[model samples]
Target: MTADLPLRKIIHIDMDAFYAAVEQRDNPAYRGKPVVVGGRPDSRGVVATCSYEARKFGIRSAMASSQAYRLCPQAIFVKPRFEVYRDVSAAIRRIFSDYTELFEPLSLDEAYLDVTVVSRCRGSATLIAKEIKDKIRQQTGLTASTGVSYNKFLAKIASDLDKPDGLCLITPEQGPGFVERLPVGKFHGIGKATEKKMHELDIRSGLDLKRWPLSLLVQHFGKAGQHYYDIARGIDHRPVRNFRPSKSVGVEITYPEDLAEPNLILQQLIDLMGKALARLTAKQMTAHTLTVKIKYHDFVQITRSKTLPQAITGVEGFEAILADLLKDTEVGVKKVRLLGIALSSLHSPELLHYRQTDLFAFSMPSHFPN
Candidate 1:
């Protein structure tokens, strides 16, 4: 089925250690040194991103800040300046606009561009990618890695093949063989748990996955099995969408001191929910589901959720629901270190008014506002 479709030229661009690079570029002293961005070493926060120098010392994003400190004691820890990063990201998007309007931004640091019909650089996807990389460097004083391929899946994989200012191309002729030799864990959507499950099933690489019958793969992995089956053959038909909507709005806080009092915990939840409601309102959307999460001091975590028939517009609308959800958890009986509230099943009121069933779609990263 995929063979009959026309080949599309896709390019994936990823900034190298984006946050840490921005910090280094802004501060000359931090250049060539290991820089960790996110939280202070003594705090309970985790590393958001780090410089390449820090990667050599076994530091990585999402590692505990204290653990990162233990790995590289000399690594400099700094808080993320999102405002500055957003500005730089906007500038990079402008550069993308010059090449093609079919670009889809995956995050502030990376995007997928469909330049299949673009005539820039004599319609060479590789040259277009190179020009975009050069423009980003000239404008932002930062480096980006680009991967060019016939599909999004392979292009994204190719982008990560080389790092810290590198460019790589994977042609249609090389896609199948390239995927065959790759490890199952290296596939983008295959995480640790799924990779382990695949290993237990004797599916250790792309070749192994390709050998599984569709019926057997679906029996084990359900709907995602089809994706695995397709990508193993170097096939992905998904297009690059320019406008992606926000899937959910959520906020969480990790307190410096654990809360054992029910009243205090309730107050904190209210405060967090208020922030999330404000974000929903800002986006002109309402949610039908509300969830409350609690992480106890010993790291036992639990969540309770409710789906309402009507959209939730404000915190007052769900105050009772929040209390009911909290009661279901052992919040007062346990020492709570984190409290989070998330609103999902979101829809735009304007769209709902017209009875549009297809809700707006976007990506919202989970935020830890502690």
Candidate 2:
């Protein structure tokens, strides 16, 4: 037994239903409504995440708005305020910096902070977590849940045990036993799909999971199977990396007024595509996924994507592909309203760097028969 395994005190903090919380914080009128955030249901938009009130009516993020409408027609729907959310995320990240240099943000609303190596704040992780929660609520008018344990797995799982202004700390003594009794779905990194697979294997619970042979697990589940064996006994060795670089860099625009002209739309796409392609050059990355998002006047939205065989790393090449998609969309000036171009499958600047060429005034493609 490695008694000297560096004892870590990690805190996982997640804001309670972030976007909806912001709406409630800003508007008194929406406080009690079943707030659904994301694309509008009538516009063929998808749910980002619904408030608990909306969730009660069987709404969730990634579900179609029509389905959600069928479930709860009376729910209040709102678009995502990502700019405000990003600003709030920055403010909360600042608080983490005050505690330790070892902060790892999972998303806009969640992060894991390792406080074991701190020389100044000497006390229980629980106390620091409580103080952080207090500061967040005071500064942002938002509530967050905290989970503290020796490793990230235990810490993340512990945080979810109690949610929406909850704190849980799992000591080594309690960690293993807790994992044994945990429902398979509660394990970190276990998605809905994996939970179903585990169910088929008769791994109804963590105790049942612990009974699977290592070879069989590896045969069926590959590397994740090995990960399963370790967390079943509450073991995780991943470190917190805070200066994490962004993978893809792109820009988007929402039409204050819905556009209808084809030439006007294509011209706008050119400008937007120019900016996005320029960003790829600035970041010195290759984009594997080229996504063209079209939002209609009625607010119904559709996103089309093409993952290329070759990684695109320049303005001219990527923009050409984007223009092709735009031209083929066939949703002409009358119906088409907003266009957004995004590039993903990013290669780090470490892998590549900015390659610049002065070619902004490229000619428009000759495809549409006038």
Candidate 3:
């Protein structure tokens, strides 16, 4: 575990309404006016991103465009220009690379940088973040929000505290108190379902979560419980790696309407598995862990996973596993809105190395989120 080591400087940078901001920058009319970058208002489309001006009217990303229209009818809705976004993203990446070689891009508009050993800007992570933000504004005519801290979790959270051209810092002295005061739902990995579970147990804030015994959390939340235990105490050890190995690869489909027919659902699963297998083949990797995810009409989601003794490459071998997983779920009895298949514990033959001292090596528990 690296917990005993000295703290490192980590920074998380997220562009402010990246798509919408670009539109506003290119088109002068959108300045100080609400702008939305997404699908048409009349279609069954969702808002991808909206300007801060639009947010005042309660418009938000993922809200149906129709609802966003009802919230602010005059808001300008523009389709996404992914190519332009990619160009701007590359420009930002160049700026980041100048400060630190340790870059872990979370998405096109967000990334993490480890500047613990970086000498640029006099080795000040905060100064590096400011300079990066300034360079982005100068080059792309766009604004970004930045957060600086000793770990990834806090750095990410701080970035959102004051958004739209904001910069915030959470030092080691502030981390514990900041986490304690934060709402339980605000924890990075705790989704709506987990938040409901936490609330059911009278855990509404980080302080409340911290008071619970680690075993109790594990018993209630499975592997995710250990994650909750550590973050509540402001203990996250996840590193910023230049290359993050894909933990799992999968594809999922959400139907417009709930599916009731067993045969139809099986067909969907088969199609999904075919797509997953194709990707696995493309990567030249084999998977030892298979998981099937089901989301009911009411949005209740469950995953059934099975681990094989050895990795397999053929799609025919997964049929039995898929059937068994479906049989264990409530897909047939209840309406299903989504179905997915994921492959994990992957290994590439070319990447595997043998050692005489050990047959295989497992990372310490601290290597993961917990």
Candidate 4:
């Protein structure tokens, strides 16, 4: 794995408060106020993004906007300007392309770039990150946090260590000790339920986590346990893969806590479906398979999926299909820690049915909005 490691300098860059920041930048009056970009609290909505000002009041993205309002009543909320954000992302991407072709965009707000042989940005990865942040702020009027490290895992985690215009670096020579001092929950792959399970096992930090045998971890958490073992040692070999001719397209996240409420969990699924659909449409592709993953409190994970008769690209339709699939509580109430949805068997956009066959009859008219 070490031999295959990317010798090229890889950097992860994530925009701070993407949607909210854009709103604040475009609308000068929204500055310094708690700005939320998502649906309203009155309509069973959650925050998609919020400004750092709002964060001071403990408001965060992916949380109920009502909760944000309760936390910071002075916050200004706005609907998502996805098109504007995409245009901005395109502009930022054009900057990265100036450096190298080996760019992998993780999201509209974040990307992984390999500047190995390229030297256009001056100095090393650290310097490049600083320049990139400056350029993004100068051109797009948005602050970005950056991570410079050998692998994707370290780069991603390092970027989050300091946020809202942060730049963090982790060298390969720094190695396992860096991870050892890391909190049990702070390890890249270890999330809420896994951390709790590790705590039960008397493994409360990265150092404490290392005491356990790798074989034992495999026995407990299955494949993920092996991943933990590797990451704890600062060894993540997963390469940055582009979505070139993809077999599948999907999005998912591991929550900070186990979701005990079924309704709340369903909402998470809807959100994931929305993101996956965005990716699908952006890529101009369709799917013939749908997979829903549930990671239980006990660290056991099960994925339920279905292969449709025809390729599907409709975001609302895909969500409906997922809701239908999830109607049966066969997985039971296990206090899920992670829920993800993915579509597979991808085909070209032309090969798939992407048009409105019956536009007026559709329940989600906005799905094909001009």
Highest-scoring model, lDDT: 1
Best by TM-score: 4
Q: Against the true structure, candidate 3 has what lDDT?
A: 0.75
Please report the TM-score between candidate 2 and the true structure.
0.70
Alpha-carbon lDDT, every model: 0.77, 0.69, 0.75, 0.71
RMSD of model 2 against the true structure? 14.1
N/CA/C clash count, model 1: 3
- Candidate 1 C-alpha error for residue 179, in Å: 0.9
Candidate order by decreasing lDDT: 1, 3, 4, 2
Cα shift from native, residue 246, model 1 (Å): 3.6
Work out how many backbone clashes candidate 3 has. Answer: 0
Measured against the true structure, the TM-scores of the candidates, in listed sequence, are: 0.75, 0.70, 0.72, 0.78
Between which residue pairs do clashes occur in model 1?
245-361, 245-362, 246-362
Q: Where is model 4 more than 4 Å wrong at Cα?
A: 1-8, 252-270, 281-340, 348-370
Candidate 2 per-residue C-alpha lDDT over 1-370 given as tens digits, one digit per residue, 9 for 90 to 100: 0466666666677778888888888888888788887666666555667787888887876565667889999888887665577677667767766767666655567777776655433456776777778888899998888788878898787777787788887887787898899999988888766899999988977788788878888988998888888788777878866544556556556654566656555545555554565445433456888788888887788887888878765445554666577776656745765678788887765653422211100000111011
Assess candidate 4 and give its TM-score to the true structure.
0.78
- The sequence of per-residue lDDT tens digits that candidate 3 reaches over residues 145-166 is 8888778899889888898888
